[model samples]
Target chain A: MIRRPANLRRFGLGLLVAMPAALVVWWFLAAPLLVPGMAPAFAWLLQLIWPQWGPAVEVNGNAWLVVTTLPLLEQPLQSAAIPLGPRRFTAAFALFWGLVLATPGDLPLRRRLRQLLAGSVLGILPLVLLMALLAFHFQLAVVINHQPALTVTPPSVHVLALPYPGWQFHLIGVGRQLGVLVLPTLGPVLMWAVLNRRFIRAMIFTGLLSRLPAAAGELDHRDGRA
Target chain B: MSRGLLIGLTVVVLAGCDAAPQDLRRALAMLHNDQGAAAFTQLQDLAATGYAPAQFRLGMLYLQGEVNAERRTLAERWLMRAAAQGDVGARYYRALLWLSRRRDADAVDAGAQALERLAADGFRPATLRLAQAYEAGDGVQPDVAQALSWYEQAAAQGERRAIERLATAYQNGELGLERDAALAQRWRRQLAREPFSLSD
Candidate 1:
């Protein structure tokens, strides 16, 4: 109403809300993936079994793979698209937030697309690291529980190697502890951002339509004056 | 004809309908009285017209190998025919045949199609077998949805094993379920009851 532009404020507010929420939900859902009694997780995982998620690493009674986490995003999206109850509400909330936060106002269409992509990448980058750490912990737990007899191999070597130490991680460099945003994977996030933007635009459509009455009233008044 | 002869004949014929009702009651009594051999003979004569219960019972006898050398495939074929004609118990036995061969998906399909007859009143032994099918992945894809469906069915029918399975599914949320602690507790509480449904 006063000074600042409505578009910029709304976009900032939207990003400030949605991106963190997506990460929060990712971490929340990752609890079952990280925890034990994971039959349901594996059962659901079976549905996600693609050769592309990465090669499977069978350890102990469990298995883990280093797939791009974008597949995870798709599962939740497909889940949310036709879900019932509170989960549906959560998806709507996330989509709405993504639109408001990621989009840039007071810019041309091309620049706006650029800003939105950049913002979403900055937001999603941390979560990818979190997911890799989670995978390492889960796989390590599996291997430790199924240690072999100490006859042929030394006990110290195998037990400790099941979980590589921090210095070892620094030296050998496995897992996503370092926040290297996979530039290629951003394509999926951008696709989802586009989808989320469309969803928010859908919700805001009714407000846009509310102006139709005012436009009609002004058109009638102008015709009378003419 | 003489009047005395006519009156006597009329009285005798008039008493037959009353005896028909009494005879059915007696048949149920004889079946319950451990006079299976005699009751079977009577039921067999009555059942020859292809009544479903007679066909089901005779099918059961053949299925169990007690009355003679068990002819399971033949028994299943007859029971399948009886079940198709709406014999409620026949679905239960026929499900067993499909299950024994690890055809759980087919068994479950059979159980659900016949639910209005078999599981309509309550879960029974046959219904519990359907639940086991979902759990063990015998003939169907291992699914929490189907497992939960069968567990709830058998639990309603008073199958203890089904009650246990439902408890596990609820407690673990193993079947794409949201964690509902209250429903899990309720199922646990219901566990300590007498066998109330047809499962007994």
Candidate 2:
């Protein structure tokens, strides 16, 4: 039991030490490899919406995915931004590294590997959902915001119909914000907590009750003269 | 092993290898593995040899900001070479680079010509660029008629921006087109029919 806690602490320390290196690898190396896979997944998600129609994703060697739609009219307008970029994937990769490093060390290497893999899979599910939401937001943003570079005569017509509903944009904005700011950090922490619940419980018990002399004295009050 | 000896021996062996294709593959592998600087070194000789793909790849690496200022100039040179060889990607990016850089009118004209060729090949983005060029006279003479025609072509190809522009122009009598609310409404109806899809 003592060794287990020490091992857990050691694992936590290992994560602290390894995090910067992990982030570097995630940004420089892992993101590029993941882009090819991520592009297709983003396309597949888009395909789910348009049925047979979907944007095509091209992977640049620098690890960016350029999403192109088939001619919306006479020509294809490339989407304003990459559907998923290094910034998006790097966060999740950092989370994976955290999970791998901080997972309970008493578990066998294979078991730990399985846990890491499972945690990564779970983390990616929500990320993919976020990507789809961002893609929709981006497509709308490009369509509405992009104007041809030439001056056309002023139109008297009022644009009564917004292409996308108002609520959807709000929702996408919130989801994207969360994806960038919260999910990357929180997702892995939650996974780590869940996977190592027993260790956590033990740590809690050891930290609060068993390790406290004051609590032990309180327990012995019945036999005291006072 | 002495460092100089090791370097000399490796250079001699690499010189004898003479397999540009394999070197290119190795460069690609290095890039995929996130060794962009190394990939650039590998690509240099092949690009100098006038290989179209290597030139294109070098241009991309330069665009990626993987290389310094000197290399950035090399990127334009390589991209121009690739474009001359009729590489579609090279043509597209070189056009974009010229536009983004907002180079002189002559450069803009060159970019427009590249775009026009691609547009002739039925590429929608090129068609859109050609329309913009005609409308703004950015590189070509401003011709509302040419612009509208290009817009119509793009809209026929299902370009969303073109559709929106055409609808607005028809409604407002912009771009020298006569105001026709009926035609505008028809395009609006088409826009409505092509709904944006997202899963909840």
Candidate 3:
């Protein structure tokens, strides 16, 4: 029972207005608070994965500082710190919200809000977590490879050994590159498509509506005009 | 009209994100999406027509995923062509490919020589790589003095790897250098000032 052409215009205008507003709100309000708040979770995860490193995470503004022990060759444990900006992975949250808010106004407000909550928890959160882990591993590998005194063993069958194998570094490299380049832009679009499949189909396939039982004769008059 | 507008907007966004030519950008997008065969088909004509970026990208594709001797040779040829056109990335990767042939002493020497030239041009990665080669005696002789000098040069240019190496070397008195806590502390401070980024 949705109107064609007019609703599409509304959707476009809504997107144009909402996208930048969402991005601004995210950058100033949400990201600054959320990224810093993520430090504890990341610290716990890193500690679980790499207990030998004795990972300690601290927040400095929006960035997380990870202090860890470096096991150099024939030397006592040396301290090193790596800084990570979670904002890079969290921008998709804004994009997803923008798309959700821009859905056709005819839809129930409560349903839209529900979709927003689901998208945030189900899609964006997992993406941010995965990207952070990949980025952290890649950064640590680079640091380990740079240290001349650290003896890295050759490629081993065990992938997660303390002294990382060469192939693991390569795998981390590819994962990091994909996380940095592709996921930020594509993740939101896919989420929006999944949530708005009905709306999308109605907009794209007006001719096919005549064959459906629900709105068969209802859309027939407009099909020729469309 | 709305559909047309959406398509237009998508094209504008994609084009605005990258400064590369439209076709080359499409090829790169294909490659990113793991459409290797399609990307190869699109890039071949551009690379044949002497587009340096296309040559470089095509060469990189050839090196990807279970590369054999034939693919390596093709990669080298395309990389050399791109390097001749002054693609810095191609030149660096070509040197790396040469260095990977460790059993071939001549190739190793050639790679080391390429790295030295790139370092002289103030490419930070090249400076760091040359220092590592000197330290590990990968292709060059194990000269502690040369390694320290190259590491210093790279560190001065704000290369994080070189800074880390220098900090460790000075702290441990490794690489035949006298232990200097002050220098190590200075390098560590510099390292802390360097921002972390995923890009090389």
Q: Report the C-alpha lDDT of model 3 over A1-226, residue by residue, as the tens digit.
A: 5444666788889999989988999999989877877777677667667654556677988788876543222211123456777788899999999988987857688888899989988988788777787777776766654421123221111111122455776787787777777888798889888989987887777534533645666577679779
Model 3, stretches more than 4 Å misplaced? Answer: A1-5, A72-77, A147-163, A207-226, B1-200
Q: B1-200 in candidate 2: lDDT tens per residue?
A: 69999999777554433345445556766876888778778888778998765677778777664657687687788889977987555677688667544547777767777777777765666787788878987657789999999999988865666889999999999999999999999998877765442221
User: What is the Å distance of residue B12 in model 2 from its true position?
Assistant: 56
lDDT of 2 at B36: 74
- Retained true contacts (fraction), each candidate: 0.00, 0.00, 0.00
My TM-score estimates for the predictions, one after another, are 0.33, 0.43, 0.46
Tell me the tens digit of each residue's lDDT in model 2 across A131-209.
Answer: 5445454443334322111121112111111123345545655665566567766766776778778777877776666
Better of 1 and 3 by lDDT: 3
Tell me chain A's TM-score in each of the predictions: 0.27, 0.68, 0.76
**Which scores higher on lDDT, 1 or 2?**
2
Expressed as tens digits, the lDDT of each residue in A34-149 for candidate 1 is 32333233323322342111222222322333222111111110000000011211232244335544565445666656654554345432343234333333333222221211
Question: Candidate 3 clashing pairs?
Answer: none
**For model 1 chain A, the run of ten residues with the poorest summed lDDT:** A76-85
Question: What's the best-to-worst order under DockQ?
Answer: 2, 3, 1
Model 2 stretches astray by more than 4 angstroms = A1-8, A63-84, A125-142, A145-162, A211-226, B1-200
TM-score leader = 3
DockQ of each: 0.01, 0.02, 0.02
